[model samples]
Target: MSYAVPTTKKLIFDFIASRDTVSKGELLQVFDVTSSSLTRLLDEMTTEGILEASGFGSSTGGRKPILYRVNPIHRYIIGFEISRIGSSIFVYDLQLNQIAHVRWKMDATMTPDVLIHHAANQIESILQQHHIAPSQVIGVGIGAVGPLDQTDGVILNPLHFPADGWKDVAICEQLTAQTGIPSFLENGANTALIGEHWALRGEQIKHMLYVHAGVGLRSAMMSDGQIVRGAFDLEGSFGQMIIQTDGTRLQEGSNYGALEAYASIPALEKQVRTQVKLGRDTSLHPYAPEDIHFDIILSALADGDRLVTDLFHQTGAYLGIGLANLINVLHPERVIVGGPFMNADHSVYDTVIQVTRKNIYYAPDYQPTFSMGILKEDAVATGAAVMVRKAWDCE
Candidate 1:
């Protein structure tokens, strides 16, 4: 009679993935499997080069069991991020160290096919640069501008890459076909949240929220250390939440009075431009519309430009209002703000704290801890690479 295959291998993989190291006996105890079964699983994994036997464990009045760990050089993954201004590609080993990176400005005139082909070429170049073999590359994880169909990896009419013909583009399928590797797609903000979780202050925090304010504003929620990909992967579309019933006119595909309309980089630039057009007395007037950017405005604020300071304060207040709502609903333990706008002066953060405290019912009595993201600009790319290891239950 044929016996059913046990899940010892999966159990061992999960146990080792969750911890830095473990002993064979601990694995048997955790999974409630017999020593023979555990040994079989470990032996098979060791033979496959998926698990490596480390040094001996501490003695317990008997023979010390050999320690086991997931192999770091067993595989590699490609991580890609498509942003409004440009794109970035990273090669990561199973240990989550970035071995190589490539970034370039996105061409406005390039069609989707051209852009994807260019991305593929860049990834290939990065792999070749690192001397990584094709067979060892597990897959590609892409964190891209959304409204994406995550199931099919199709970018559906993204606002940032409008001219790039993003409508119904099966990005993952195409990349997979070109590279002969599996592909996974996720929202950029969601990936940022994952990266933040992976790189926490000390112990990994299980529940957190990541808010990204750049050309657009978006939030991603993580519960129990896993991303909450909502129905159709739209769970964290906080940018569309209406905060003001009668505020500025909404951009196409945006909800009227959403915080993003008033707080995103484009929104900030538009407001700044309007101020300049109206001949406001400020140093920003010297900069042409093309010269105006998030970094420029933030530097202006840092240099004590009152007009820029006031604009960021207002923007931060709006962001605070959104964060208050999120805190009340999700009650996350931590909230991390990242992206271009978050790089502004402390005045912006002060405004956010003050406004959030005023608006939130819980307020100072029970505020969720807040901080800037640890990874900052690298959050999305790092998360995309970590996603591959996570998929294989290696990290």
Candidate 2:
């Protein structure tokens, strides 16, 4: 059984959670309490299975100090990522180790009610299969494409959901009501960034940027270890930023020639289809242009289809311009790009790097490293679980 974690206990756990292992002496130095008092708290935490003595620390002219760490199995967290293309759920231990995961493709049948009930049922199944008591779970954290009322825990009118009932849905409330577990909601991009931040806690990256290219482009920023939120939760606003003043394509409800009009996965498909109509020669000519999907495009890309490669290069250049603008303003220490568009040896990623470098303000001293997201497809779901951990720390 775990003991009640008051503010002080939570603080200690937070510190220990942030590191691989921490010494009792270090805890005493950090927290303002008598050594005996702190010792009693640590003893209780260890006895309750919330913390474990990992090993001994280096001796400082005395006996080696004992190290303590949050026991990975002491508690669990559930993370959910709801997207227009797909949705996923992840179960993680206190240490953010993935215990179980499930995913499903988004379709017309996946309305709000169906999705929530399915998620709730799956949570129960996973808990039973893993021999985890429902009480062991900390809470559920949901990351979805938004325009969300995060304070009210509602999914606002996000565009392009496969189903019609996505608007103004109290998703968190519904999930919690069904499962009897607390749930929190945030933008998927923010959650992905949060997850990346947690995974790289050892790296201590304070300023970071995360961009995801999928049905649409979504972005989130982390400044000084905190996820930055705008007055309104328009995480997809970056996608609407005008990239070309007189360019042809315009995303629904977005500015003419928006970045998303050119860089999004749907846009890539559209571009490919347009080119096919214009009789651009490629291996994809065998497939009906209208039937061409992201998977088909990727298949053609893998087969070295010149038409597909050229289109990807053009798409990457447009996205790079948007990224360059962001980098100049934010000056983040690192940028992580993710989504279906990213693949091994894809020209899109390579071209994005080249164009970004070509456009960004030149400075020998300023170098912001760019790479693909480490969490990949699991980023949002994993990050949602990490957000639950963060909430626990606050509590």
Candidate 3:
């Protein structure tokens, strides 16, 4: 269709979106445009209500320059992210304030066709619930478990999914076709990292490594305010890293142990079940072994269940080995651990941290900042919305 090349206005809006506010002088210097040209562009953008002159900034020498910022309601985006726990869709205004959200879980299955159909329908229902017309939404974005064909928006065969008929589901094309709006897709780990980045405003810190622990465990890295997307969008396959060349596991098909098989919710659940079967349990007696979910084990740990707590210690030690490799190699300024793993309570998180400290190669003083994910359960959906903003912001 040969639309005009990206305009200077996009550059200006992007700059304003990143900063809380920006001045015309700052725009001129960074954008390499003359004063008059910058003035015309900003004026046009403000008139369109995509941007606004917020107030005057402190003057360096001349009159105080007017500060510009994006209009919070200029557009809206809907984001979808599905995990083993459930599928969720959230609506966000341009400023990324969540407008509405809907979620549903399947205790037995999370097959792709069913997930797509439900998630897309819920997105429509959310828009209607908020009295937002379909036309008001600029686009949609999805953050699903990856090993995706990003170019095609097809979720490839990822681990822990349905055993059969689960390959190359064109999520983006389906959602767009269903709703008549443009769509984008990204892997869950990248979206989680990006959501964390957006929450932090991504200006102060340049390097971050985020570990996602759930049915599958993986890590995402960001450097210089950019996601480290590999050639095929599979940069953060940290889970598949062979941690043991001898031990067998049920996930990701390994005769040797993989990271997820050792350090994820499913793995922990598996371990808990096995130990109980071997007659090695105490406080988890109220629930049958088959009924012991990750959450229940977390409760058991809170009640001072020695088996559960010690089990987490073991899991944490395994994660420490992986994090040791991650920290020594990546040297990220901050490390964030998130996902259903956090639901295990602070003791588990503390154990992971304590073990990580011992395993890192660096001296004690040089340790990177480590913490739990602040965005909680909504990180992936929030990050997917951020992607929609980034994808459609230029338009």
lDDT of each: 0.78, 0.87, 0.78
Where in model 1 is the C-alpha error above 4 Å? 1-7, 107-111, 201-204, 288-291, 363-365, 393-395
* Model 3: CA > 4 A from native: 1-6, 59-62, 162-165, 285-288
TM-score of each: 0.90, 0.94, 0.91
Rank by lDDT (best first): 2, 1, 3
Shift of residue 64 alpha carbon in model 3, Å: 3.5
The lowest-lDDT stretch of 10 consecutive residues in candidate 3 is 1-10
When summed lDDT is taken over every stretch of 10 residues in candidate 2, the lowest stretch is 1-10
Model 3: per-residue Cα lDDT over 172-288, one tens digit each: 898788887788878888888888888888547889999877777768899998888777766236766778887667554553677767887778888998898888857776667
Worst-scoring 10-residue span by lDDT in model 1: 1-10
- Encode model 2's per-residue lDDT on 274-324: one tens digit a residue: 999889998888888999988889888888999888888888888899988
Q: Which candidate is the best by lDDT?
A: 2
Flag regions of model 2 displaced more than 4 Å.
1-6, 393-395
